[model samples]
Target: MTTGAIIFMIIAMVTVWGGLAAAIVNLVRHPEASEAEPSPPVEL
Candidate 1:
């Protein structure tokens, strides 16, 4: 593979895994928020 392709692959991998890690941390910090259901819509 080309050097540019390798670099792009590394960047893409980092971005995806970083996002996943952030999501997991947020869920851990706010367990209730992830588990709670949304409220029903109000009647007019």
Candidate 2:
């Protein structure tokens, strides 16, 4: 393959994988409580 093609592939890979890694890291650092119950509805 050409140099330009190789560079593009590398950039594309980095962008996709970088985004996935960032998402995983963010999820791990700030996880939500799945078992928390919602408040009951209030009557007017």
Candidate 3:
């Protein structure tokens, strides 16, 4: 594989793993820890 391809693959893998970690962390946190309210639906 070319140098550029290897670099791109590494970045993509890191991004995917980071997203997964964030999701799991969010799920394991207490409900009271959430402070943001859901936004209202937009009328497109």
Candidate 4:
């Protein structure tokens, strides 16, 4: 493989892995907010 292709592949792999790590960290650190009560609908 060309040097440029190898570098691009490495960057892509790191980005994906970094994103997954950040997501997992956030999920573990914070309580799920999906169960919170919704505000009453505003009448236009």
Query: What lDDT would each prediction earn against the true structure?
Result: 0.92, 0.95, 0.86, 0.94
Which one wins on lDDT?
2
Candidate 4, residues 1-44, lDDT tens digits: the string is 99999999999999999999999999999958876978789999
Candidate 1, TM-score vs. the true structure?
A: 0.70
Q: Which stretches of candidate 3 lie over 4 Å from their true place?
A: 31-44
* Model 2 regions more than 4 Å off: 35-44
- TM-score-based ranking, best first? 2, 4, 1, 3
* Candidate 1 global CA lDDT score: 0.92
Give the C-alpha miss distance for residue 27 in model 4, angstroms: 0.4
Best by TM-score: 2
User: Which regions of candidate 1 fall more than 4 Å away from where they truly are?
Assistant: 38-44
Tens-digit lDDT string for candidate 1 (1-44)? 99999999999999999999999999888787634788889999
Candidate 2, number of clashes: 0
Return the TM-score for each candidate structure. Answer: 0.70, 0.73, 0.62, 0.70
Among residues 3 or more apart in sequence or in different chains, the pairs in candidate 1 whose N, CA or C atoms overlap within 3 Å are none
Write model 2 residue lDDT over 1-44, tens digit each, in one string: 99999999999999999999999999999897877978789999
